[model samples]
Target: MPLTVNEIARLLKVRGVSQYGREPVSQLEHALQCAHLAEQAGASTALTVAALLHDLGHLLAAERDNRADDDLSCDDLHQYIALPFLRGLLPDAVLEPIRLHVDAKRYLCHAEAGYWDNLSPASKRSLELQGGVFTAFEADQFLQLSFSNDALKLRRWDDLAKVPGLRTPPLAWYTDQLAQVALPDNQAVYQRLRMLLC
Candidate 1:
């Protein structure tokens, strides 16, 4: 089932208390910081929400053990995991960016001179699991995506959001914004009915 705004908030408030992979901050802290950065930059509401939830897949990962998922032989692919879960609840504007934010990181490392150096140790390790830096052709292909630019911006915020003890808006603040963007309860049923009619 698609998560409600309250459910989303509860997940962040509860599961998010765990450390973010090996990062210095907790998952909730990183989420709030990224959303705060996006809002301060005057990004669109969808983008702000995307920033807030980009790493939700990590929290949603069932096998997550604070450090377990990070050490897996393969990439956790957290960017894509939550999409099916969030698909109908959020508009594509919000969902697409969340789906692409990790690629945005790979893109930056490939395209920018010193981006690799700036990554935290855990981030660097995860990068290898995330398919490492993109190849030249891959970078070009990634740029062709619709929300790739937004994903890039979100990636920058994600990188900077790891500061410990950094204060940002409360979870309620984003949940309020989320309520505005989330599909109304009836909208899903109406869409299903429409699909059945066709």
Candidate 2:
């Protein structure tokens, strides 16, 4: 079933407390920071929401000991994991970027000089697991996608969002934005139809 905006928020509230895979900040903190950055940069509502929920796949995947010391071997493929759950709930503007953000990272490393040096240790490690840097052909192919530029912007924000003590608005602050971008509530429509028929 597609998750409601509120249901997504609730899941973030609960599961987002986990440490972001070897990052200093919690998952919620990273998300809020990314959204804050996107908003500060005058991103559209869908882009901002995409920034906020980009890592949601990590949360929806099975609970993990994501602590800095837990050397887990699995690569989770988190970028694609949440799409099935979120497909109908959000617009392509939002969902497409979330799906491509990981690849954006890979693309940037190869396209931009010295980009690889800036990645956090965990990000660098994951880069290898995510198939290393994109080759020239791969980068060109990635650029052809509709939302690839937005995905690149989101990837930049994702990289910068890991500051340990950064302050940003709470998750509740984005509730209205989430609602604005969410799909119409089918259950509510169904109930209204039932009442009309009755």
The lDDT for every candidate, in the order shown, is 0.88, 0.87
| Stretches of model 2 off by over 4 angstroms after superposition | 64-72, 185-198
Q: What is the TM-score of candidate 1? A: 0.89
Judging by lDDT against the true structure, name the best candidate.
Answer: 1
Task: Give the per-residue lDDT digits (tens) of candidate 2, residues 1-198.
Answer: 567777789978888887888889988899999999999999999999999999988887755444332234666788998898788778899999999999999999999998999898899988998899999999999999999999999999999999998989989888679878877775356446756988
The CA-based lDDT of model 2 is what?
0.87
Looking at candidate 2, what is the lDDT of residue 159? 96
lDDT tens per residue, model 1, 1-198: 577677789989988887887788989999999999999999999999999999899888833555543454667789999898788888999999999998999999999999999999988888888888999999999999999999999999999999999999899999899888888864467457766988
TM per candidate: 0.89, 0.90
Roughly what TM-score does model 2 have, to 2 decimal places?
Answer: 0.90
**What's model 1's lDDT at 185?**
67
Instruction: Name the runs in model 1 displaced over 4 angstroms.
Output: 63-73, 185-198
